[model samples]
Target: MKENILVIGGTGKTGRKVAHKLSKNGHLVRVGSRSGSPAFDWHKPEYWSLALQGMDKVYITFQPDLAVPGALNAIEALTKQAKNANIKKIVLLSGKGEREAELCEQVIIHSGIDYTIIRASWFNQNFSESFFLEPILEGFVALPQADIKVPYVDTEDISDVAVEALLNDKHNSKIYQLTGSRSLTFKEVINEISETTGRDIAFTPIAISAYTNMMKQQEVPDDFIWLVEYLFTEVLGNPNNSEITNDIEHVLGRKPKDISEYIKETAATGIWNS
Candidate 1:
C-alpha cells in the first residue's frame, strides 16, 4: 500500500537515502527540512504541522543527535504532533548506547502511534560525508577516542532498514540495534583509508579536554562542541557500545556492509583522494 510519507531531515545522510528508496518504490515523499516546501525546523514547532499535514507516515532523523540536550522535548512534541495529525506510523533514526537517545525512544514508543526505532552505532559516512571529511582530506584525523573499537554501520544499511520499517507493518513497535559485522579502532579505520586511497592519512589521539579546547579555538558552535565532548567521553568511552548486532540481517535478510567495502566504495568516489 503506497502512502504519503514525510522524511524529516530528508536531505541528511540516512534520510536522503531513505527518501530516495521510498520514492523509487512509488511512495509519495515530502522532505522535511528548513529549506523544504512547508519548511520544517526542529527549533520552530509551528512549522511541523504544515509539514505533517496529509502525510500518512513520517521518517524522523533528528539533526545533530538525540543525545544532545533539548532533543527529548523536541522529539516528544513532534511525536504528539504527528499522532495528532493522524499519521499512522513513524520511523525514528536513533543512536545506540546513549541514555538520552533511549529516553527519546521511549517518547515515541508510548506516543499512541505505531513506531520503529533504528538504533545505530557510528556511521561510516562520517569520513566521506560529514565533519570528518575535511580532516580526512587534510591527511590527518585527530580525535579524543583511541584503543576503543567502533562497529561503524553504513548509512546504506540504515536506509534499507528504515525503508523496510516505513513500508511494512511487521517492523512496527520494533527496536533494531544496527551495527557493522565487525568492530574497528580509529587507527584501523585510518589505515584502511590510507591503504585504499593510497593517501598518507594519519590518526592522532588527543585528550578530551584538548580536543574541546581545539574546537573552541576553531570557534565551533558551543552546542556542537558540547555534543562532541559528550559523545567522546560518554558514548565512545563505554566498551559495551562495541558489540555487533544481527538486526540488519534479521530485517533485510543480508549481512551489513563491512568497513573495507565502505572504504573501497568511498575511495572510488575520490572524496578522500586529497
Candidate 2:
C-alpha cells in the first residue's frame, strides 16, 4: 500500500539511508530536518505537527541520540503529536544498550500506533562519516575504550531493516536488535583501517576521566561531553554490548557486512587518507 512517510532527522546517518530507500521504492517521503520544508527540529516541538501533517507513517532518528537528557520528554511529546496526526506506523532507530533509549522506546510502544524498534549497535560509518573521521585522517585515534569490542553494524543494514519494517505490516510491534556478524575492538578496527588504506594510523586508549578532560580542553559542548562519557562508561563499559546478533540477517535475509568490507569501501572514498 502506498502511504505518506516522514523521516525525522532525515539528513542524518541512518535517516538519510532510510529516506533514500523509501523514496526509491515509490513511497512519498518527506525529509524532516531544520532545512527541510515544514522544517522539523527536535528542540522546537512546534515544527513537529507541521511535519507530521498528512503523513501516514514516520521513520524517527532522533538528533544526537535518545540516551541524552530530555530525550524522553521529546520522544513522548513527539509520539503524542504523531498519534494526533493519525499516523498509522512509526519505525524508531534506537540504541542497543542504553537505558534511556529503552525509555524512549516505551513511549513509541504505547503511542497508540503500530511501531517497530530497531535497536542498533554502533555504526560502521562512525569512522568514515562522523567524529572519528578527523581522528582517522590525523593518523591517530584516541579513545577510552580498549578491551571492549563492539559489534558495529552498518547503516546500510539498518536502513534495509527500517525500510522493510516500514513497507511490511508483519514487522509492526517487533523489536529488532541489530548488530554486525562479529565483534571488533577499537584496536582491531584501527588496524583494519590501516591495512585497507595502507596508512600508519595509531590507536591510543586513554582513561575515561582523561578522555573527559581532553574533551573539556577541546571546548566540546557540555551536553556532547556528557554523551561521550555516558557512551564510554555506561554503554561500552557493559560486556553485553559485545554480543553479535543474527537480527540483521533475519530481517534482510542476508549476512550483515563485515567491518573489513566496510573499511575497504570507505578507504576507497579517500575519507581516511592521511
Candidate 3:
C-alpha cells in the first residue's frame, strides 16, 4: 500500500535519508522544508498545515533539538495540525539522554495519532558533518564528557528504523531507545578517526563549564551553548546514557553500524580531512 509521506526538515541529515529511502521504496515523498513548495519552517506554524496537507504520514525531525525551549508547544501544535491533515502516522526522532526531550515525546505519545518515538543517541555525523567537523579538520578537538561512553548511533540506522516505523503499522505507539551495539567515549572515537585518517588529531578533556566557556569565547550562540551544556552535563552525565540497546537490531534485524564503520566511510568521504 503506497502512501504519501511528508518529511519535515527533509533535507537534513536523517530526514533526507528517510526521504530518499521512502522514495526508493516507491512511497510518494514530499520534502517539507523552508525551501520546498508549501514550505515548512518551525517558527511558522501557519506553514505546517499547508505542508501536512495531502500527506499520509509524517517524519518529523525538529530543529535545534527537542530539549530546547518552545519545543513542547511546537510539537503539541504540530500534532494537532497533523491530526487535522488526517495524517495516519508520525515518526519522531528524539534525543536518547535528554530529559526535556522526553517531555516533548509525551506530546506525540498522546497525540491520538499512530506514532513511533525513536530516542536516539548522539549522531555519528556530529563529527563528520556538524560542529565537531571544524575541530576535527583543525586536527585538534577539545570538549568535555571525555570519559563517558556514548553509544553514538549512525544517522543511516536512525533513518532506516524511522522508515520502517512509518511503513509498518505494528510500530505504532512504540518508543524505541535507539543506540549502537556498543559504546565509546569521545576520546576513544576521536582516536579511531585519527588512526583511520592517519591524522594526528588531538583530544582534550575539560570540565563541562570550561567547554561552555570555550564556546562562549568563540561566540557560539547562547542558546546553542546552553544546549551543549545541558547535553554534556545533564544528558551525557546520566549513567544510563551509556547503556547499549538492541532496538536497531530489534527493528532492522542486524547490528547497528559501529562508529568504526562510520569513521572509515566518513573518512573516505574526506569530510573529516576536508
Q: For candidate 2, lDDT tens digit of each residue in 1-274?
A: 7779999989999889989988888899999999999999888998789999999999999879899989999999999999899999999999999989999999999888999999999999988888788888898888888889899999999999999999899999999999998998999999989988989999998899998998899999999999989998889987889988899888889999998899888888887774
lDDT of 3 by residue, 1-274 (tens): 9999999889999999999999999999999899999888999998889899889999999988999998999999999999989989999999987889999899888888999999999999999778998999998999887888999999999999999999998999999999988899999999999999999999999888888888999999999998888888999989999999999999999999988998889889877777
After superposition, which runs of candidate 1 have C-alpha atoms over 4 Å from their true positions? none
lDDT values for all models: 0.93, 0.91, 0.92
RMSD of each: 0.8, 0.8, 0.9
Off by over 4 Å in 3: none
Give lDDT tens digits, candidate 1, residues 179-199: 999999988998899998888
Query: Residue 148 of model 1: what lDDT?
Result: 91
Could you say which candidate leads in lDDT? 1
Model 2 sits at a Cα RMSD from the real structure of 0.8
